[model samples]
Target chain A: MRPVRISQIYLGLLLALLLYLLPWGGFGLLVRPDFILLVLLYWLIRSPHLCNIGTAWMMGMLVDLAEGGLFGQHAIAYIVAAFLAVVYQRRVTLFNRWQQAGYVFGLLLIAQTVLLILKLFSGGELPGLAYYLSSISGILLWQLVIYSKIKVTGDKELG
Target chain B: MAQPQQPTAFFVRGPSPFARLIFFFALSIVLMAVDARLHYLTEVRQGFATMLYPLEVVASSPIRLYRYVTGYFSGQTTLMRENGQLHLQLTRESVELQQLITTQNENAHLRSLLEVRQKLHYPTKLAEITHIGRDPFVHKVDVNIGSQQGVMAGQAVVDGAGVIGQVTRVYPFSSEITMITDKSLAIPIQVERNGLRAIAFGHGRDETLYVPYLPANVDIRAGDKLITSGIDGTYPENLAIANVKHIDRDPDSPFARIVCTPAAGTDRYRQVLIITAPPAVPQIETEPPATIRKPSRHAPRQD
Candidate 1:
């Protein structure tokens, strides 16, 4: 009925961060979705004014710290992804729900690719295909949230 | 820091996404260079990690609760069986301990006879594995104790069985250990049977350590036990490290590819002992010259 509030956007991001902090090891860690990025993307779509590329960058810094890798790895990735999400945001209105899912999947992939390049630059070995499993699970989670939103609002809009 | 705002009315209220991207991207690149090359961010990282400690505890609470519940509801028979097994093991190890004591004393006596330096026993602090699998590309685990408990980076970690890893990062409340099976860690080791020394390096995956640079004709064999050589001064002498599992001596290659399984149950063991880093070794006191020497270089010619 009303537009999403900025507080709600922050609350979602906080919850996603907590999820990211959870101790998911081994197989679970391999498939654990990038929860923070998903939440940031959702808010960037729903309320670009409240959650913009800057918000995305800050979240990325937090994720990078939590992950304990080289600083700015996740920040760079999120910047690229958030920039794409905002650039095509207008076109999002024309695309259908499935196409929207595909678009978000591509964004997640780009983010992961950027992170991978940074990782390789830092003398890290090439990871196996399973390294990209997180993006797959991340998009699945995005679709799940989208489906829930449609069910709750009874609307056909991408936003 | 006044950030740029959107100059024109648009769908969004902030600066154009492109401008924001360029700004953050440049900032991040600088951060990455500083963090990866200069390594000036450890204090910053530690401060943030300490702030995140409470959230980490909260996040890990579910697993802790699961463990607690299982421990509480454990069958009495299971406990009794475990207790029985431990007692048996204790008795078995006590016999070995008696033999080891005699050997240590004899070795000390012989060293004293030879005027060799006495070996020092290192003190250890027990820590619980708070979490495992930190860097995805690296084999790392975080323990409950940190600098507050005198756990410093470069300290060797071990279990009752054998070497576990080394503390690489120390925060206020927790420390990160880079396991010997990580690509970045290497342990100086010697074969138990032959005393042949080599360095074992982590292969980055499959939980295997490989001993490289050994000539193909070296006397190493499959199933040979490897122990810490102690030359590195970090790990004490004679601690179990691994058992050689495979050795490939190809004719084309001069060196053997020796892979070994770590002796410690790193995946299952939750409790580990962190051996404090050895203090700066005392400089050996040298006898001073009766008179101050001068122009030694010119006077060194013997007729």
Candidate 2:
């Protein structure tokens, strides 16, 4: 398998940020996936040496700035998720595609739950159940990427 | 195909993942505290927003192009129909405008004679909404105009219907409006019918405003219109704000639970007018009448 280039990872993260910056409105905004987090997670799981907790925290800070919410909410959430992913990186690579997807889904949920808690602490009201829809959509997107034969785990390592 | 085995790292990275996590987590908590408590990061936020302008433009281009195309392809019949309706409305309003001019002239003469403060004519600039706020929980919108266009923070934004919001943050080329339905916004309002004044707060989870702290037996009723009292000096005087929807008066509770539907299109409109003038400060009379010295029970409601 070809080694993943550091430039490619950075470019992918940038593209995800741009997608996040899109002018989503109405129902689209409610269900929009956390594109930057998903990309950061993918890199952390696939190429941990290249992208680590600091990278995730930086991206999370960017998200927080863009969101215009409580300043560090997304930063802490992303770092926590990144930590989980890094700690279980090897176990996740050994799993089958479905198991890996489930693990990623769990990480997404953890990120969201942390964010929700932070928001509540900041006096934000509880949003409806639709808040979790983004996690579901994110996992679905991950599945689509896997189906397209872009292995999240390094192919040579899997073999 | 032969693959190379993973090589052990010769040099250690700066810190372990957990240690780095702890450091970043603590840093984030400090940032959150500073931002929420002191609000010392306004310039930081504005600088980042300005840096993000190019990406925002790229992100919004698709919608802008779509709007341009659709506007270009609009049918001639629809245009003619709209034009005719506007013409008829203009003619009807012209009659009312003539009367308004005569009344304004008379009011000016009377105010001069009585040595009263002149009414301020606030200048307004029109702005187009660029995007709705990304966070669904916050009721805010980004408008195209900004400091470059003389848009300032705390200016009142309104549409043809009524007040929409106030400018909360201004960038170089854009500004953010925190809508009347946002959790942090509160507007001083007066009931149109009985002249009772109260403060209306936004319900965070919904698009309604709540008039809390009013006594259960307050004169406010369902369907009563609430207009800006202008006592707060943020919103203009007597502009429509909301219509009281539901008033829940529970026997156990001391305050009335009043829900109001906003008068403006809180989520629908694409254009609004920004009133740019700062609010006029009320003048204090030098000589006080003995009768007026004592506060009347209805004094607060007079404004």
Candidate 3:
């Protein structure tokens, strides 16, 4: 019923980070969605004033460190995604839940695609279709969060 | 009638998103350049990662607890069977151990005769896999021990069977191991039969390695074993790396596409050893000069 504070967004980001830190291996790792970006996007769309590109960039660096990959790779991707989300924040309020879901899906893919491009430039091998599966799963997660009554700032409230 | 309204949330003054994007983008570029080119961020990354170590432990505890509980409840029969198998294996290896002792002594005597330097012994620390790579596309695993346990980057990681990977990042309480399946990984290897040397790269998707750029007529066959050659000094000599699974040579291509399945027990082993020594850094030599003697105005070279 109330606008979320900046601190709450930070707390959520930290929680997402913790999730990222959880030990996963084998098939479970192959399917692990990008939790930090998911939360960042959620907050960016819901409360742009609370979380912004800077936060997203910081989280991306953490991911780069965690994955032990090229520095700023994830940071760059997250900031780009956050920029799109912030730019579209006002318009997303006009859309229905499904439309917002589509927008979020696009954002996730954009982040992953940017990361894939950077990785390829660094001489990484082609990871194939499975690399994009995370974005789909991330969208599913966004939808679940939306349906669970955790409101994004723009979702219309019915009387 | 409503009283005069206060300014709404939208009226708040702040930097525009475009400006913020440019600022962060510029900052990230600098960071990426420094991190990629300069290697200046190691200490910074390590300190922050150490600070986040507790959160990592907290987040992983629940999953670990669940696994422990499930294993405890269902492990009785499997444990008994495993115990039986191990007893048989122990009996088999015990016989081999005697032979190994004699062979080791003979090898030592021969090496002494040849005046060869003794191989450096590496101490190892056992660490459990705390988590897999934070990003799905990257192949890495976090081990429970880190700098606190003296883990250093580039230390080879191995499970019970064979090499798994190497430590690429080390935090305070934990370290990240890039699995041999990761695309960025490359290990120097030798064919067991002919001792031919080549580098094996991670296949990026499957748990396999690819020995590309080998000539089509290369003397490698399917089922050929691959092992660490030790020339690079990152991995010890003779550790089983992989076994050749398939070889595809297209008439159009210059090199054969060789695929090999990793021999490491990534699927079965939870605990792995981290070799403590850093891989040896090779010395660099500078070229002497274009001319043997420069024409100094004041001096002439002696013939």
Best-matching candidate per DockQ:
2
Compared with the true structure, the alpha-carbon lDDT of candidate 1 equals: 0.85
**Per-residue CA lDDT of candidate 2, range A1-109, in tens?**
3567778888999899899989998889888999998999888887788889999999988888777788889999999999999888877877877788899999999
Candidate number of the best TM-score: 1
What is the C-alpha lDDT profile of model 1 across A51-78, one tens digit per residue? 8899999998988877777899999999
> Between which residue pairs do clashes occur in model 2?
none
Q: What value does the lDDT take at residue B160 in candidate 2? A: 90
Model 1 clashing residue pairs (backbone): none
The TM-score obtained by model 3 is: 0.86
Ranking by TM-score: 1, 2, 3
Local error of candidate 1 at residue A83 (angstroms): 0.7
lDDT (tens digit, per residue) of candidate 2 on B150-238: 99899999999999999998998999999999999998999999999999999977889999999999998899999998877778788
Better of 1 and 3 by DockQ: 1
Q: Estimate, for each residue in A71-131, the C-alpha lDDT of model 3 and write its tens digit.
A: 8889989999999998988787667777788899999999999998888877677777878
lDDT of residue B297 for candidate 2: 82
* Residue B292 Cα positional deviation in candidate 2, in Å, after optimal superposition: 15
Candidate 2, which CAPRI tier? medium
